[model samples]
Target: MNYEGSGHGLARFLAKARQGQGFTVGALGGSVSIGHGLKRGMRYEQSAYSELNMHRIVFDYLDKLFPAKNGRQIGGDNTKRGANRFVNGAVPAIGSDYFAMCFGHHIPEDVDLVLVDMAINDGFSEKGAESYETLLRHLLALPNRPAVINLQVFALMFQTIATGGDIHQGISSYYDVPTVSLRNLLLPIILQNSSYGISYFDHPPGTTELDREGLGTRHISAKGHGLIGRLTNAFIDMRIRDLVTGLYGAELESRLVPETPREQIRALQRFNTYEAIPAIPPKCLSAHSRSPTLIPSTNKGWFKYLIADQPGSIVSFDFVTAGGLVQLSVYRSHNAGLGTAACWVDDMKDKRVIIEARWDDLVSIGYTVTIANDLEDGDHVLTCELLEETKDPQKKHEFRIIAVIR
Candidate 1:
């Protein structure tokens, strides 16, 4: 959690907040950001079904500390339930590709502060990185240039190999955006067998030793949420205090990031600085992949794509992208019924990639996989065909495409 200068977008929020103006705080990301296992084992007498997430805690603090004199809220209702507006646009299993493709529908336009947490969900992929950059650009290009913070939440998975974090950190550094690292704050404690780290996280029954505690592969416990929330509030309070003290001088914000000497070299070598450009909201072809045309699914949303189990069934899409990245979103789950599909660009069947729909997870989620990258900035056609001929009879023989992102 580094200071992003007095020009931080959040400073505007603090200013408006001090003036008694209504403010809205919004969030977007995957399962962790939305609190998946949060209610499983409640603590401190926390409500089982309450919207008791870390962001919600932040919202509560803002509502009380900076009360709007007019009592105006984004809820637009006379009630105080949603005063000083809070929008939760997070989809549990979706990645940045899907979120950037459908940003307009999810995020509120009048939001003063936006929290984006894609640290763990965006598995290492160039498409994920591009979409994240595009999303940040859109947030920065907003009419008011509302404050956007990149909150990279980490789990025990970081102890192993890379989990799409390096790319995210590099991108954040390049943009010099206001980003926070939960991993940096907590990882060392778990590594050193510290006592506080063990208390902050929950483990299986009677699993006490830190070395034996499987790197937090599961959702963090309620107390973990509380600590993070309190810490975040503390950070915000410090910034608010600075805003009130005239510490944010007229100096311009720094454009480069990762102020270290080695990091500065990497930041300068990059040819294209993605500081310009707006969001590219994709044409969501949910259940229409088989029909070879864009159509609404019976499920009636871009969040879910449905494909029938038929051999040689094909879904085709033609798109033009200046960024030269094509992404395919599909359902990967533990279900045996999910079918496999072959994806290719520009009718080049020779370079097609075989995508297996089955995953070891217990739940079904919209997972984005890169179909093609490093293409020319021109017209391209993407083809996906279902290969249903398998020896397993109980197989679902189904493939779902959440969206086709460019």
Candidate 2:
């Protein structure tokens, strides 16, 4: 494959890793997001026509190591179902449970590397982890126990940071796995804004804190995307470099792909907005005065849905922290189009927050809550305090749980 301009960098990165040594990679959780990238990088770095190259590389590597005979399936069938789709397929797989659900199928009898990512969804309880462990042990007992790279869920940043790495360390030792932690990689970046590689876009004044609407859609801004793209390329190159060095002696001559020139990467720092606010824990609920009531609609084995009334109440949340800023604006329906409220949070003498919904009315619904940024850090009380203000008190619906936000 002839790669020019930006593509050349990607090409060189793959070739070096392939010629250096090979690896049979089996990815577990978050296969589509993290593992898909790894497989892509591996194939591209190794040679031209490297997209499905992972399938070919894995097949060849495993064949040499295990050498299958008879009409037996090379790797187990369950794992193969999903893993094979990632190979020789145009579109990447979607959904969180795809890999874990298919665990019984694809894991090979002989494996080299196993990359696992769990905790992506914070709502998943401990039972989910236990189930995964059972499957993991089954795979580990195979002929060759693969080297495991367990990617800690980025969603648990607050919990993990508070533990001083104990949680990750215990997990690693428990399963005898190596942890490829994003926190370790991100600590220095957070310390220095410039070191963050991507610019943190500051929202305009009088806007909700880090709320998607105020910042606009697309999590990363345009400049942020370019910076992220470069950082991703550099990170992949570094990982491949380390893997190659481990497999082959360091003295081996190899062309390591260089990072994108700093000057070439446009920095959006000029427009960076400075705000003093704490980061909200992922998936946690927050409510502000005069915002819509947030209700957990449906429960799916621990994953709860947010439900709310439609067309009259407004809700918003401060996803990011801000210093002493308290102007709250209601969001138009997110799932519904604009200029409509989904639910209502009653104002209590401008002190406490109340949520009101109709129990009698039957409607296909969702959940939402108001989030504000102007409250000072101290002991503040939030209660589920439901009101039966509908036509009849007996006909009113009560919100059982009201998620609190500091």
Candidate 3:
């Protein structure tokens, strides 16, 4: 059975929709949440996966269940009041390590419902664990008090979920957030021969996009996406019955306990909203000729990762903040053609964190590591230079800087 916890968060959102009120739904995940390879009329547009993915399905269900009435006045006009908005904040090759710091830029703070699909494309490390936890803590501590769901999807070639799921599951349990695992819920259908063909559950033949990743990740077909939508809708329908009968709030309120899992998680929230953090997307410092190589790594994704190939090439950003711990989001890989990055604050060249791109792993992932821990409250220059050589030349010299966060 899927974990619904106290069902309070879901019930609250449902209660608002049942009253014809507007709400904002959001999703944070990897490719599957956005219907990456699923072709819809040979395009990647707003309507591409509008009916297939679960994020859109949740939005569609709310719209159908709560039809607009009387052309309600909203946003200084007669629209958008009873309309529910879904923010699809999923990127193709990103993991929670990227979103854990960059979510504030993508997801609205006033969102009502959040769907998390990080079962795959997740880093299997302690950093991955804390980053995933950081994301949950921040989302749960939001002012709107949205319902968060950990939607565990399956990885095709691996035939298993992310090893990071164990940590994601425990964090979800610690916060009592709703979790629905398709791997756990629909095992029988996924394992045995079903009505759906191979294409339904897999990507097209001869495509090594995910297969060559060494992790065996693949995109779900349109049919597979539809099934996910249906399964999520089933949970919503169950909550709807409770909402109609007034058991939504009453049952949860009556069963409230003093020591709550969610409340405990709230106290431990990360990246204080009140803190004077630096702005996102620090200005590029590379030359005009090199700008093209420094890719803008975003497509509904949170942040960018800049790559430096040649030695003496440096990426720098100046930011002012009431200083605390400083962290840098970068790309890490086990494959070849990666380099080391020398990261540090202004003038403190001796105190720098040398980021190694290659590690003993099978997959490349987004990672965040501390670069500077102590900086006085003032202005500072952060830099990451590509080193000419590294301890391991098997992996080439190419430094990647995802983002610098305080």
Candidate 4:
């Protein structure tokens, strides 16, 4: 039951579970490590074929796209089967969408258990909890969905055997699904094993000094991973079989723990920019009834801001006058579009100057047009063009500008 410090115990559990019945396994997340583990568990005679097909597909694609000689890792006669692998760098931000896409394609209805190990990167940011919740909802909605088991890591566990209950709680609630908090299950073992060199045991097959460092940590080591992979595969397969084996007997499984590329042909459409604030001059600038007067003074500067579709979103416009004077300022509520405008001085810098706007509702959005008279005389140019952000939830538009001064 406790898989943390005892790989043998974990492996034995898996082996025993395989006697229950049969089941389909699907894995997705940071990498192919977890799935490989599951494939190894299957203990099926045909696992080699399945794993080979997956390795071929993944490496072949990688080779064709990035032909670096040293990058290739998956080709050999001993290559395992049922170990398909695909990598999507959408670890943190777009994790919800990534998982959605994976399940939407793989893991058909008949699957008994689906295991996922993700969120290591998501927890690295402030918005990780929110993203995880979204992923949970998507899974719960699947009518034919299998039982879900989410695996995770904790920040502090890297060095000690401490608990990660808080992090695990966040994960469990988000998915509203079952989770195997490995932090709780494996911490003790991992801590104990920390002293031992890598690999399941000493004198491992093809043991090398490097391989002994503890079975590769980040992505799972080649040999150590293979061992864990087989154990996990066996465990999950057994669990699934037991869950559905008897028609009306005590459940064999612990708890019925059941379970598009678009083209770029239309270049015209490629240049399309979805305006955050549709190109429109600030209400103040429009009201002033003058395309911002090109101030020749080096003391004044211009700025603009991009705001998201949230209430209280405000874009601040600033201008600094000659003699270090804070001349004029404007605030535009980001209602529903790409909105921008500029200000200028007549005699400060002796030429036009522009600075992109910074939109921070809480920050003092101010810029010095003069900068202690830093503008050396010559034909100066100032320009600002609004940008349209693509409709991506993760993309944040703070500020940007276009200009040229001669």
Among these predictions, the greatest TM-score belongs to 3
The pairs that clash in candidate 1 are: 337-396
Residues 95-195, candidate 1: write the lDDT tens digits: 67666665555566667788787766676667668767766666655555667777766665333435555577777656556666666677776667655
Q: Provide the clashing-pair count of each candidate structure.
A: 1, 25, 0, 41
Residues 211-272 of candidate 4 have per-residue lDDT tens digits of 32232332333343344344444444444454345422354324422220011111112354
User: Scored by Cα lDDT, where does model 1 land?
Assistant: 0.63
Q: Work out the TM-score per prediction.
A: 0.71, 0.32, 0.77, 0.35
What lDDT would each prediction earn against the true structure? 0.63, 0.32, 0.63, 0.33
Worst 10 residues of 3 by lDDT: 282-291
User: By lDDT, highest first, what's the ranking?
Assistant: 3, 1, 4, 2
The lDDT of model 3 is 0.63
Give the C-alpha lDDT of model 4.
0.33
Per-residue lDDT tens digits for candidate 3, residues 276-342, read 4222322222211112233332222113346666777776677555645677777677665787778
Model 4 ranges off by over 4 Å: 1-24, 32-94, 100-112, 124-126, 153-176, 181-186, 200-216, 223-406
